[model samples]
Target: QQQVRQSPQSLTVWEGGTTVLTCSYEDSTFNYFPWYQQFPGEGPALLISILSVSDKKEDGRFTTFFNKREKKLSLHIIDSQPGDSATYFCAASMSNYNVLYFGSGTKLTVEP
Candidate 1:
């Protein structure tokens, strides 16, 4: 069974607008949340991450808001741009485990 889940299978936004992707997990043991961005024909790259102890994390235009109590989180992309269009994946893993459970990615398109 998949422990991580993402919503809105796909999304489209205009340049300069912001987009939000929601994710949830079933495993309470998962404490580390990482968001990855993938471009066509390329492997996913680590975008940003947050620990269970953190309520929020931000890096430049990307931010992740986590709710440990609810085992849910959301990634926000600010100042959306055409170059930012890609498949965004939210993943979770246990502190001691190397395996990461990834949610169904949200394909985002930033139209100019």
Candidate 2:
């Protein structure tokens, strides 16, 4: 199956807390790893990404830690804020560069 499964479709965190989202894939050929973030009534944007060759990627408050050997990955948001409250989708692809398998998305609300 070409499905990338994610858990806890929603998460609530404090403004100064940390949030974690998880994802797993069944595609053995998957190569591209991308994390998209979205806000209310907006399109998803590429927050951070890592090639299958890399295991971790960090960009400021957002970080993606991947385990290619285990077919699993996670996105961590440090010092989450109300502005960070949105949907996080973990996606995977096999170099298709067009069709990306996206998780259902986790809705995170950071309380201030």
Candidate 3:
């Protein structure tokens, strides 16, 4: 069973636009959420994250929103650039554990 579910397997966004990737989880025990960004031939890197207690978090062009009540979360990238083209993954984990459950990922293409 997939614990985390991500939508829109692929997405295309124009430069300077905003790209949104969303995910939902079945586990209410998940206390930490992180969104990872990966480029071709490279490992995924932590882009941004939010804890269960936080409703939203922001870092430069990236932002993450958590909705614990709905068991959902979303990552937003503003001013999307060509370099931002990559696979975005949403992951969840319990605060006490190091294990992470990842979604299928959303491949974002930023068109210049």
- At residue 77, give the lDDT of candidate 1: 91
TM-score for each predicted model, relative to the true structure: 0.98, 0.94, 0.98
Model 2 lDDT, full chain set: 0.90
Candidate that beats the other on TM-score, 1 or 2, i.e. the better one: 1
Candidate 2 deviant stretches above 4 angstroms:
none
Per-residue lDDT tens digits for candidate 1, residues 1-112, read 9889999899999999999999999999999999999999999999999999999999999999999888899999999999999999999999999999999999999999
TM value for model 2: 0.94
Ranking by lDDT: 1, 3, 2
Q: Give the poorly placed runs of model 3, Cα more than 4 Å off.
A: none
Clashes of each: 0, 0, 0
Model 3 C-alpha lDDT per residue in residues 1-112, reported as the tens digit of each score: 9989998899999999999999999988999999999999999999988999999999999999999889999999999999999999999999999999999999999999
- Higher-scoring candidate on TM-score, 2 or 3: 3
Point out the worst 10-residue segment of candidate 3 by lDDT: 63-72
Clashing pairs in 3: none
